[model samples]
Target: MNVQSKYSILVFNRENELFLPLTEFYYYQQKRINESSALSYLITLERFFSWLAKSSNYQGTRVKWSDSHMAIRTAVENYLIYQMGCKLRSKENFQYVIMTKKSPQTINHFLAAIKSFYKTALHLKLYEFQNPLVDADYSISIGSFSPTSIRENKPRLPKIAGTEIPSDSSYRSQSDSYFKLVANDWKPNIIADHDLPYIIYRAGSEIGWSLRDEVVIRMLFETGARINEILELTLGDYRQRINQYEIATLNKGSEKRRIKFLRFSQDTLKLLMRYVNGERKTYAHEKQTFTKLSDSEVIFLTRRGDPYNYNAFYSQWSKIITQAKIKMNIHKTRHWFVTNMIRNIYDTASDGGEIEMKKNELINYMKWKDPETIKVYEHYFNEALFREIHENMAKKMQEYEKEYLKKSHSSSEGEQLSSSVLQTKAILPTEEIEWINEFYKGME
Candidate 1:
């Protein structure tokens, strides 16, 4: 029986035989994709292989030895059509049953996995034939279809087509439009500031509640850190005196490490210390006693004393929100923090220098390489601040005009200036104001 594992991905053929070539490819892809991602790719491969074994186009021949590109292309098209008409029963009890067609995005993802698999196989010399998908574009329009083949009234399925690969700039340009379309309607789900106390209370209110969940929730909102970053925290990362924690990243193959510090509230600091000294201590002690269990230094741990994985943390979060009667996801905590932080900036940043200072602080606290990333967070454009900016600019302009008029009155050019000012009627004429209004009207 095949059991899905996060540490490694396993693929089996229809005959329940181990598939080594694709399994090795999963390991080779570790630097780029995590084990969970690799498992998804392996599953795509497993389904394709299973289909290939039964496909009449190849007469039960292995895909690697199927030299005819036309036969392979036909089989792939048929497989996609098959997938479009199916749905999974469940993750644990896996089987594809008849359902409405899958989305184009999903089919494209499957194509990507299959393409990557073939590329790896070729690089590893596991396949003798040239990659059948070398010229395939995996776009909405995939291949040739007869006039009567597709139902005219229904949504058209993707047809396979051989097209030139898109340039990086062209792809990015297309992606920008897609991103804008998504961004137009998508707003971050954030917990309002007034509701946070109740939510926090609910997080820790349940009977047999783990202190770790409350600590994690508090830290996420206080530090505005990524969920993975919080989950990966260790004992040495925290500084109790400063109420701050250090986040360090060593890239997959890099020797150098980059570090950043994030501070939390004193209240959060107390909760963190409590979890570390109380609940975490118990889990660590249990882990030490169990020789079979690997000792992990992560601050958050499961009941079994194992370090908390993303899935485990998410599951815990789901239950907490359900109990709290809140609809917010865990990631929204970061959004809530950032959105409220920006609101604080609006409250305190009275001058340009102060605004810049707060901007830098935001960038540093978020540990974002690109300052532009802050735009992704939810923000309210303070109407009061906007009006204040226009008022300040008008005041400055008036002050400058007054000083200019005083200078002109005393200077030799005063006669010419005074005559021009008189003609202009206080240096801002009704006609000029009307012109400005007309320009704004054009804009409208």
Candidate 2:
């Protein structure tokens, strides 16, 4: 097997069989798509090949070079079984081992990688036998009486000009709900409204984190920006626009264009400036490792003053959130941003125009080309939104009643120490007010 890779990528032929070509394809696709996504496709294919080699060995047989139709099918079945935490005898180690099943999202991604490989293999005529991954509309079998035979005799399906890859629902919704769970479980009572400040204090004070690390935490929670976008920023990128400080970085999408953030807090701006004008100056000058590394120039630097590694940054971030008792993925920050923004519209009882205006602002703020995809955030934490609105409405009603009762007294409080004042409110409750209270009770 000839394995070649520049980064952590694994592109190799297995026992002289070129079941996939990922290097060139990955590179080609990276230019057209996100680099992270391209790398994931390559890694998934590598794992699939490993599974195929192991599966073949488990059955006491070697994979054939020519007729891999059965091999592909069997390999996939074994891989799926293995993913379900089944005990399987490894051909490589010759010992029974537990095969840990991946998430539904990961499994689907792996399937896509295999499907794409087969599609390419068939197009290039890499093998004489049929590609098992072909759609049911096509035939890849030769003279035989079976489902395979039917496809063989049937005409091949026309290839579409373009294509590509949902299952994160259960996994993600759990975290979304956790973020909206508020402080019933929190010792300090960190609800949705106060989560930002609560976390900021913990990250900066309890952890005593470095300016760079603290800034990263702030950027994640405050702006809900992607890690890549934050890592791509520089000292020069932070610009002043009138009274506000905005940072323009490339947003996540096909276009990958820069978008300006106009909603960062003044304290966050000060911390960022402190890091840039103070510590960053001393730190940036001390870095001497990996002279050609892009991290050397990137704004968020490691203790060694090099650029942040994605895995390292993520691992450390997850640790921080866990230590702080924030029970969710960092991506919840993005969800928090959208979810709270929606809640704010109702908090102020905004009109159609104001509500629609905020949505438009969000479209530009998040760099969303299609507003439709952004609507998904609206649905997240919907139950929590309902609870919050209900609670606030109930409070407002109580305040209205107190205010009405206060008219019968000289004080704001109902502490006139007289039954006549209380009788005044009791005797003059409006029919409309009674109806409204009744409606609220029904809503509750």
Candidate 3:
């Protein structure tokens, strides 16, 4: 469909017949899945389709794909060959750079996108083809194609055999696996323990901030919640439950869970209640963009009495971090919370005392999907935490030993002094002693 050099989505052709089903598939996911999660699928779909439109084998001087017959195996093979020879343009440091081929992860994304498209399209009866991506081991079904298990959800995508990859621009086939590119490893900057208090204190130092801002900062530290999760907290979560204060929140994954502030006392809850009763309404008074504060039920509001969006929250966070002069960011607070909890609990468990920290407990507290990801990515996942905790416990034990020795010396002197005092009291006149005691009581 070379109707134009550019592909107009509005104009349909046999080429579009190939692309439309995939567009519909991802669009359906965007509507159903969380928007943030769906964005990746949508981006990948567009990239794959755009490549298909431009690829020489797929679209070279072709008017209609529906008119010309192509087998699924031929389509997949041609696409894979094109990918190996593809040179991509990107801007880095204000300069353009051409990449020889896509990374392995990107190559895998293409496979996943096409596989999902074909599977979904076939199921909906939108179109049908012999899907070359499917292995004989698994039966494809549209009615129940979605996997429930985490393992099944993340099944390894089949890669195009290295033998099929083109060696040069001439399209000579290569039997080697030299074209694959690996994804960079994730390395998070660890946040220190004391950084949180300094940040919160600095946040409070700012003028025109009601308890709403303070609550936002404190709740983030207290719950180890993501910023979006705290921002989305509703007034309904603040309602009293069974004579106790509790807050329910939805995390990044859209999993709703309750946070009972046991670590933070009722006094902390009182600060929140105070905000609800008075400070929430007061935000509108100081805000230039003030409107009806009742419009949004979200707990955290901006100076405009509008809900705290990502931009507003990040801006406020940047100001606080700048004033605090700390190397930590917002997410580092979550890291700080978990790291300190694990370290402190481990330090307390010395000398055969039962360990209060548990993997399952951390998973539930942080509202993580599973233990594996947290282990692989979070603070407690590394042996560095164990080393830090062990060192902390050793220092605490030494301090305790010094205090015990000092107490023992004081006790010895006190025992002798007590004996002398008893002797002196025995020798004193009972009436005089009683009189002195009564005089002291009268003064109190």
The Cα local distance difference test for each model comes to 0.58, 0.55, 0.52
Instruction: Give per-model TM-scores.
Output: 0.50, 0.54, 0.45
Worst 10 residues of 1 by lDDT: 175-184
Clashing pairs in 1: 142-159, 142-160, 142-161, 143-159, 143-160
Q: Quick one: best lDDT, which candidate?
A: 1
Which parts of model 1 have CA positions greater than 4 angstroms off? 1-204, 239-258, 286-296, 321-330, 375-444
Q: For residues 1-444, could you state the per-residue lDDT of candidate 3 as single tens digits? A: 645532212223345444565456655655455333344455665665455556635444422222222444345445555654433332231111122436233455455555555556667767545444554334323233223222211223222211111223221111111122233233334455565665566656763455776777776676676666677776555442444445665554344554432234466677876776676666644332223334237776676777666556666666776666655556666766766666555666654335434545665666554344344444443577688799999998898678657767767867756765786688789999999899999999
Model 2 per-residue lDDT tens digits across residues 79-111: 655553334443331223233434232443454
Count of clashes in candidate 3: 0
Q: After superposing candidate 2 on the true structure, give the runs of residues whose Cα lies further than 4 Å from its correct spot.
A: 1-5, 8-35, 38-69, 77-108, 113-208, 240-243, 254-256, 285-297, 303-306, 321-330, 380-382, 385-444
Which candidate, 2 or 3, would have the higher lDDT against the true structure?
2
Best by TM-score: 2
Which of candidates 1 and 2 is the stronger one according to TM-score?
2
Worst 10 residues of 2 by lDDT: 177-186
